[model samples]
Target: MPPISPNELSDEQRPFDEHVRQVMGGLRTPFTSTDESGALIGPFPVMLRFPGLARPLLEWFTTVTSGSVLSPRVREVAILTTGSRYGAAYELYSHSRIAAKIGLPDGVVAGLTAGQRPAGLTPEESVAHDVAAHLYTGAPLPGALYRSAVACFGECGTAELVFLIAQYAAISMVLNAYDVPLPPDAE
Candidate 1:
C-alpha cells in the first residue's frame, strides 16, 4: 500500500468526521472525492457536491440485486475487465479485493487483471468482458455481443449490464482525469 492515509486531516475534519462517523456507525473513511484525501484524489465528495451520481449508483445496486445479469462472480469479472481497459487504478484497487472476498479464484482474478478474460468463463461473463473491452476502446458493440448478452442475461439484464459498465467507465474517467491515486492499504 502507498502512503495514502489521511494523516493530519482529522485535525481539520473534527466535526465533519464525527458527524459522518456517527451516521455511518463506524470508523468513517472519509469519502475520497471530498475533503482531505491524503493521497486518494480530489476534494468534495462526488455525490455530496454533484448529487446526480447517486442515481446511477442506486441503479447499479438495483440492477445488481435484480439477480439477472450480475451474479457476484460476474459482477467482479466485469469490474475487473473495464478497470483494466480504462487503467482505473482506483476501481482496480477496490474491486480486486472484492473479487477475492466474493470468492473469485486467485487464478481467475490474476488472469483478468492482465486483460486475458480467461478460458471457461460462462458465456455471459465472456460477453460482459468483450463488451467492456470494446466500449473502452471506442468500438461499437457488435450485434453478436448484444445477442449473447441478451441470451445469457435477458433484455433487462443486458440493459443493466450496459448501465453498470457505462457507470464504472464514467467513474474511471473521473479517477483518471484527476489522477485519483489509490487510498493507502485500499486493495
Candidate 2:
C-alpha cells in the first residue's frame, strides 16, 4: 500500500496521525517515523486506515514501550526474534538499527536477523532470546525455560517479556500482511 500523505488524511485520521507522531517523537527511536514527504511509516499508516482498532493498539504500544521494565537489550532481542520469525521487513529494519544503536554487536544483530542464535549474549540476553525463540515455535514455553526466565527476570519482568514478544508478534503480522517496505535509505 502506498503511504497516505499527511495532507490527504481525513478528519478522523488526523488526530490519530498526530498522536502517532507525538508518541514516536518522544521515543529514542533509531528510525524516522515519517518519510521525507511526511507520510507515516511502517504500521502507522496501516493503523491510520482503521482508527477504531488502531487507537487501542496504539495505546497498548505506548504503554508497552514507555512503561516497560525490561531492559532495551532484552526488548530488542525479543523483538528481533519475533520479527525475523515473521519476516517483517520494516520491523527488522527499524529494530535492527535500534539494537545496534543501543550497542548490540554487529554479529549478534546479523545472527538474529538471520533467525540464528548468536553466541556472546550475556545470561540475561540469552534468556530473553530463548523466551522469544521458544514462543515463536507456537508451542507452550517449556517449563524449564519459563523457570529460567522468571529466575533471571523475576515474575513481573518475565511477564513483561512475554507481553513484549506477543506485541512484536502482532506488529510483525501487520507489517507482513501489508507488505510494508523499508524506507528507501534502509533498502
Candidate 3:
C-alpha cells in the first residue's frame, strides 16, 4: 500500500476531504498519459478531477519551494541530490538539465549520481546533499550536518528544507510506485 493512497478515500466533495485536490491544485490533465492507460496511483486523478481544489495547492507548492524559498541553484541542488539518493532515473535525468541551467557544478551533480563524496562543495549545499542521502539510506543524519543546515538556512530555511525534501520524496514514491516513465521526448 502507498504511504498515503488517494484511491482508498472517496471524495465526499466536502471541503475538508480535499487533501488530494489541495495537493493537486486546479490541474486538469488526465490521470495517466494520453498515449496509454495503466494502473493509476499518486497525484493524478485528484488533479484531473478538481482543478479548483487542486490548482491552488499545486501553485502553492510550485511557487513556494521552487519560486520563492530556494534559489534556482539551491532548488536544483536539493532536487538532484534527492534524485541521486533514490536512484530514481527519471528524477536524475530531469533535474540534470535544471541543475545545469542554474549553474550547479557539474562535479557535484556527477558525484551525487555516483553516490560518492563530492569535492569543492559549499557548506550549505554539502549539508543538504548529505541529509537528503541520509534520508534515503535510512541512516540518521549526523549532528554536524544538521547543525550545518541550521547554520546555512537558519530557522525558516531549515523548515523549508524539510518541506522540500518531503515533497520531492513523495513525488519520487509516486513515480516509482506507478513506474512512471519519462516522456519519449524527455531530454
Candidate 4:
C-alpha cells in the first residue's frame, strides 16, 4: 500500500493548477489508467500532492526516458542496474518488463536481477552497466570506467546517463518511502 492515497478528485473537482495539468498529461504514456476511476498508478498519485515539484520532474522524466541518445536497450540496462542495486522492487519489476518488451537479451535482465553483471552485452551496454554499478555502490567511477562511458556515449550522452541515473534513483526513493506495493496481479 502507498503511504499516501491518490486524491480522489473528479473532473469537476480537479485542481485548477496548470502545472498539475501538465504533470497529469505527461503521465499518460508510461502509465495505464485504472479501469473504473481512470486514476494514474505508480509514483504519480504520491507526487501530485506537490504540483510544483511534480510538473518539472515528470516532464524531465518523460524526456529522458523517451527521447535520449541512448538506445532503449542501453537505457533500460542502466535503469534496472540501479533498481537492482537499491533493491527497488517496483523499478526492477517495471523496467524488467520494459527491457524484455524492447528485446533486451534475457541473460542481461536475469543477471541484473541477481545483482551480477550479465554475460553477452554489447560493448556499449557493458559500459552503461559498469557506470550504474559504480554509482549505486557509492564509489567513484574509476578513471577507466569514466573514459569508457565517455567513449561509448560521448560527452552529452554521458551527461544524459548521469541524469537518467539520478532520475531513477529519485523514483526509487519515492517508491520505497511510500512502501508502494506492486499490484496484486503483478508477476
- The C-alpha lDDT values of all candidates are 0.64, 0.90, 0.60, 0.74
| Residue pairs whose backbone atoms clash in candidate 3 | 24-54, 25-54, 25-55, 26-51, 26-54, 26-55
lDDT of 3 by residue, 1-187 (tens): 2222334444542342354444434433223222233222334443444556555655556665553554666666677777766666666666776666667788877876666658866767777776777777767768887888888887678778767776777666655755656645454
Model 2, 1-187: lDDT tens digits are 7778999999999999999888877876888677889999899888999999889888888877776788899889889988999999999999999999999999999999899889978898999999999899999999999999999889989999998899999989989999998898784
Superposed Cα deviation of residue 56, candidate 3 (Å): 8.6
Cα-based TM-score, every candidate: 0.69, 0.96, 0.65, 0.82
| Model 3 lDDT on a 0 to 1 scale | 0.60
Measured on C-alpha atoms, candidate 2 has an lDDT of 0.90
Residue 19, model 2: lDDT of 93
58-82, model 1: which lDDT tens digit per residue?
3464445455546877777888898
lDDT of 4 by residue, 35-148 (tens): 235454566556655556666777788677666799888998899988888877767777887788888888889898778889988899889998988998778889999999
> In model 4, which runs have C-alpha deviations exceeding 4 angstroms?
1-7, 10-36
Error of 1 at 165 (Å): 0.5
Please list the residue runs of candidate 3 whose C-alpha ends up more than 4 Å from where it truly belongs after superposition.
1-60
All candidates in order of TM-score, best leading? 2, 4, 1, 3
**For all candidates, what are the clash counts?**
3, 0, 6, 0
Using TM-score as the measure, name the better of candidate 2 and candidate 3.
2
